[model samples]
Target chain A: MQPTGSVRPGGRTARTKAAVTEALVAELLEVGYAGTTIERIAQRAGVAKTTVYRRWGSLAQLVVDAFADTAGAQVPLPDTGSLEGDLRELGRASIAMLRMPHLRAVFDVVVREAIHDPAARSALTEFFAARIANGAAIVERAVARGEAAEGTDPAEVIRMVGAPYYARAYITGEPLDPALADRTAAVIALAAREGLLLR
Target chain B: MQPTGSVRPGGRTARTKAAVTEALVAELLEVGYAGTTIERIAQRAGVAKTTVYRRWGSLAQLVVDAFADTAGAQVPLPDTGSLEGDLRELGRASIAMLRMPHLRAVFDVVVREAIHDPAARSALTEFFAARIANGAAIVERAVARGEAAEGTDPAEVIRMVGAPYYARAYITGEPLDPALADRTAAVIALAAREGLLLR
Candidate 1:
């Protein structure tokens, strides 16, 4: 997180976005998506309601921007010179991301919001498509390195890393400790190694 | 649905339970957990609210009963005489379960309700624990047949089968098409065969 004194090019605008994002984070952490609303965010952040609407426009946009701006947590893809290493590194990073109360709440809201909103549905779809494509690079690198099967479905391989953790955290109401990251990564690494994750 | 003519052991009591469970399913399908209430379910089912209260004390109880019903979906464990075959069969069954609109909604409500209610959380936990333990029988049989590794964690292997599908359906807001069952089952089967899913 850049210091408030730095101002960072966008100046007051960036600060406002950060402030609104923080408010969203707080609201979601306290009450979750069902209790959160545009009006509540405005009140919590002390920002004008019109300003929130003019800028973010909707819950999806607000959540996307907030997630993107959570202390500039755009983690770089790992290149640990091996598929297993990269996935384990990525798994650790994912666990760190999940450790953030606000980010996890944003994800929860997105899933819940998509249930009833078409825009959120599209957003959810595009978000995963883009991310899956981006993350597929690890498997692609592994294939080039002669580690994984040439025809392995890169997207499925990539998804396998996150499924166990997300299922426990979101669906099963289980505690998602860091150790589970190792377990999930081990399973995916083994599966991908065996060429069993082909599409 | 036992024909009204072939009354089961509980007779009128069983009828009442079935009717209440049906009401719950309808309520969840129509309005989700947040919108459903004892009042709505009683009104919809033509069963008295007091009856619902006296029989099932909480939303979690009603949901568990509903899920256990829905046409007596107590599927027998797959014993295809092999781990991969058993997993594939179980995967197909899971996909079929996911395809049920009312059952899916009941699961959705349980997840949502668990977030705000401790009783729902316990129900969710107990439901998974019982199901996972029961399903582990397949893996245990596989181990006995020397298909999977001896030390493979039966519960973890069982959890793997459901995690990928539930994550997509419940977390990523993705369409959990039937094809995914094969993909996930393949990964878990390979991992278990290779002893990677060992606790």
Candidate 2:
């Protein structure tokens, strides 16, 4: 029988993958990236250690696969008719996402891994670069409507809008109120419209 | 002998603190917080283990003391005669500080500790709060000179100016260019002048 879309776990391979990723996240929160081992992860997932070793080949590959399987990295682009509105929505979503524990854990893993490993650092950098590239569509639309400067770099605008929340969260460990989201959006919008975020 | 201004390490206690702190930083980079032990720190510092045990009861206190002894916490306030100038100087300093290995280590310890420890989180929050309060002086000067809105929160201006650099450094792990400092200052200055950084 054909497995309908989103209706089933599909097969043994899919089930093993899901179990392994779930165990990976749980193990990450418990022992962190440095302490994670294929043996423990396999045992936690009730999968054969040989299968895990053969599939991943290395701890790095396993960790990367786990992150790829996590749902947190995917962020939606907003189209609210105006760049300001889109920015505001995106800013609010960014804050909300950071506050969510599971999502935050994913980022924490990436950040923690990047701290000591060069390859992890590059992976983290590339992941955000891709997201930033995708987010540029919002600014391109704004440019089309003459809401932003023609010479503006779209990624810069996204980075500017998202900076405050990320900075305050990691640097100060402060509580991020909803009001901050709005203020950041307004500030970024003003800067974008004023031709400040140029390439 | 009476202590003279800028004479030396002050006394024996200061010397011990300095040595222990330095050892702590080295151990941190090597073993990280989870792996840090008082025995290893004392042995590395060439200090008596008994002295370390008696002086700082717990690992937390020792870590805090190390941060206190760290020079990175002391950020000089720039009195550039205008809010714009002061903010620009401060922003550039923030970027440069992150790039510097020793200074970045100080912040990374704080951030990493705060991730798993509640007390460290409070201290991190309060330390930045105090810095923000002191930074408010810049905004106050601007407000008095009618360069900014009267209702503008001074700390908000500082945070706004500092946000981009901190966010990009940690999140993107990108190389911060000097040009970003100028642009950040200009955008923040425009916002402040336009009364965007409200209370």
On lDDT, the candidate that comes out on top is: 2
- The regions of model 2 sitting more than 4 angstroms off are A1-11, A26-44, A49-64, A71-74, B1-11, B26-44, B49-63, B71-74
| Model 2 C-alpha lDDT versus the unseen true structure | 0.78
| Residue clash pairs of candidate 1 | none
List, residue by residue over A1-199, the lDDT tens digit for candidate 1: 5433446667876777777888898988888776889899988888899888888788667886664444344457889888888888877877777778767788666665555555655666666666677788899888888788778899887777887777777666677788787777777877777788876
* Model 1 alpha-carbon drift over 4 Å, by segment: A1-16, A30-40, A48-73, B1-17, B27-40, B48-65, B68-74
List the DockQ of the predictions in order: 0.45, 0.45
Per the 3 Å backbone cut-off, how many clashing residue pairs does candidate 1 have?
0
Q: Write the per-residue lDDT of candidate 2 for residues B1-199, one digit (tens) a residue.
A: 4223224566777777788888877887788766888899899989899878777776777776566445335677899888778888988887887788765765676666666567667766777777788788888888998888879878888888878887777777777886788899888888888888888
- Report how far off residue A162 is in candidate 1 (Å): 0.9
Task: Report candidate 1's interface RMSD in Å.
Answer: 2.3
Q: What is the interface RMSD of each candidate, in Å?
A: 2.3, 2.0
